[model samples]
Target: MHQLTDCQLIQSPDDQAAYTSAINENPANAGTTGRTRRKRSLFNYSKLWANGRTLKIAFLDNPPAAHKQKIIAAASQWLPYINLKFVFVDDEGDIRIATGNNDNSSMLGTDALLIHPDHPTMNLGVPPDHADFDVIVIHEFGHALGAMHEHQHPQANIPWDKPKVYAFYQNREMNPLSKTQVDRNLFATFDTLSAVHTAYDRKSVMHHPVPNSLTLGDWEVPINRRISKKDKRLMRLLYPK
Candidate 1:
C-alpha cells in the first residue's frame, strides 16, 4: 500500500471575496443560469481560471533546482488536457509554492487571489525524495486547476467506516487532522455542478488513497500516480481546447 501523505485543501479565508475573484477571473464560474440571483449563494460559484490564460507559478523558500524542475515536470502533465498555460518564475506568481514541511495542500483555483500574496497558495511539503512526490505535485496542481477530490463526488458512494476513518486521521502523528477537517475533506460530498458532472473515478489522481482499513469490507483505492482518462475528459470539457 502506498503511504498516505496528509493532503489538506487550503480554502480562501473569505468565501465572498473568493467568489468575486473567481467570477471576475472567469465569468463561466458563475454558471450558466441565475447569474444575478445565485451571486449570494456561496456554493454556486466555480473557481476556475480564465481559459487560454497563462498562469505564473512562483517558487518561494528557494528550493533546490532539481526539486523545482521535478515540480514543473509533474505539474505540466495537465497542460495537454487544458487550455491554460503555465509560466514558472522566481518573482510573484498567480500560484505560489513553498516546501520544507509534510502537510501538502493547495488553494482551489482562483481562491489563491484571496490569500496574502507573500504567503504560499500551495505547499509542496513532501520532500522530492519521496516515492509519491510527483503524484502529490500533480494532485495539488489538479486542485490549482479547479479539480475537487474525486472521493467527494456525490456519486462516489464509498462505504467508509466513519468511526475508524475519523480516528485514523485524527490520531495520525504527522499532520494530524481534526474531526471537522476530516468531515469536510473526506465525508462531505460535492454537488454535481461543483463536481463538473464527471462520474466518480477511483483511479483519478485527484482522489485520496483509500486504505481498506478505514473502509468497510475489502473496498480500497490505492494511490493514483497518474491522471486518469476521465480526468483528461473532464479537463477537456472544462477548458475545451
Candidate 2:
C-alpha cells in the first residue's frame, strides 16, 4: 500500500488573465487547430514556459539555507531534460515559492505571471526530513514547469470505485479534500490537443499513488520516485533543447 500525499495543480484565480498571460509568454501555447500526428507525452503546451529561457525562482519565506538548497537541488533534476534554466533568487522571480504552509501546490507554467509580485506561485510545505521529500519537490516542480497529473492523462482509463475514492481523501486526518477537488484533480480527463496522446505511463513522477482499495479492480500506481523515460521525452518535445 502506498501512503503518499499528492500535490495539487493550482491555476490562476482569473481565467481570462491566465490565458492572456500564457499566450503573451509563449505564443505556441495558443495551440493550432490542425492535428499533431506524432505521439508525445502529457503536458498543456499553453502552460509551458518560453523555450530556452531562464526562469528565476524566489524563496518567499526565507527557509533555512539547508532546506532551501535541498529544495533547489530536487527541482534541478528536471534541468537536463528541458531547455529552460533555473536561477534561484531571494526576491522577485518568475516562480515564487513559499514554505510557510503544508499544502503543496503550484501555478502551471506561465500562469504564475497572473499572481501579485509579492505572492507565491508555488508552495513546498513538505519538510526536508520527510521520507518522500525529494520526490514531492520534484513532482511539484513538474507542475511549476507545466506538467499535468499523469493519472488524469486522456489515455489513463483508471476504473475508480468513486465512493471509496471520495471517502479516502475526505476522511484523511490531514488536509482532507472535498469531493469537487477529488473530481477535478483525480478523475478529470484533459483535452487531446493539450497533450500528446500515447500509452499511459504508470511510472511518471507526476502520477498520484493510487491504492488498489479505491479502484474497482486491482489497478494501482505506486509512487514514482524519479522522472521516467517518457517524462524525459515529453520535456524534450515541449522545450526542444
Candidate 3:
C-alpha cells in the first residue's frame, strides 16, 4: 500500500513541513493515532520567510500557458496580506513546482531551500476539472508561506471518525492512503512551542473537508474553496507590512 507522503498535519519545528519532500500517499511516514484536545491561539508553524525577498517559483515540467497562469493567480492571493512577493523565474526557485502528477504538495517556508530541484518539490498533478484548482494551488502556497493545516490547530480540536476517515481516503481510486498515513496527514496533531494560533477558522482554505458521516453529532466542515477572513488577518500578523 502507498503510504501517505503529503497533506498537512502537525509536525515539530526542526522537521520539514510534512509535504516538503515527495507527496506520495504511502504508509511509511505516518505516525500513531489517537485523539487529543487543541487549544486555539495565533497559529505560526515555522520561521517566517525572510522579509523583502520575492519568493521565486518555477515549473520544471513546463505546464500549459493557461495552467501556469492559474497557478500563479491562485498563489498570488496570499501576496496582498503577507510580506511576500511571488515572482516567476527561469532558474531554480524557492518553491519548485511540477505538473502531471497526483501528489499535490509544497515545502513550508524556509524549508523550500532544502529541496533538490531535480526531485520536484511540489506537484500540481490533478487537472482543474477533477479538482478545485484554485483552492489547491492557493492552499499549497499557504504551506509554502510557513502555514500548517488549520484543521490541526492545537486549540481547534476536531473529533475525527478515524476509521471512516481511513476508509474514505483509502477507497479513493487515485492516491489511496492507508490508515497510518491518514493518521499522520489528517489526525495527528503535533505539539509545538511556537504555535501562535487564533480561534479556529472553520472555513479556512487550510482546512480539509470533513463529511457529516465522519464527524460526530452536527460537526462537519465542508471543503472551503477560498481563503477565510481569519486567514487574511493571521497572514498580516505573521508578515507585517
Residues 95-181, candidate 2: write the lDDT tens digits. Answer: 999998767888888888988999999988888888888998899898888888889888889999999989988998877889999
What would the per-residue lDDT of candidate 1 be over residues 138-199, giving only the tens digit for each residue?
Answer: 99999999888889888899999999988988887766778998999898987634475678
Top candidate, metric lDDT: 1
Q: Tell me model 3's lDDT, rounded to 2 decimals.
A: 0.66
lDDT per model vs. reference: 0.86, 0.83, 0.66
Worst 10 residues of 2 by lDDT: 37-46
Each prediction's TM-score against the native? 0.94, 0.91, 0.78
Q: Between prediction 1 and prediction 3, which has the larger lDDT?
A: 1
Identify the candidate with maximal TM-score.
1
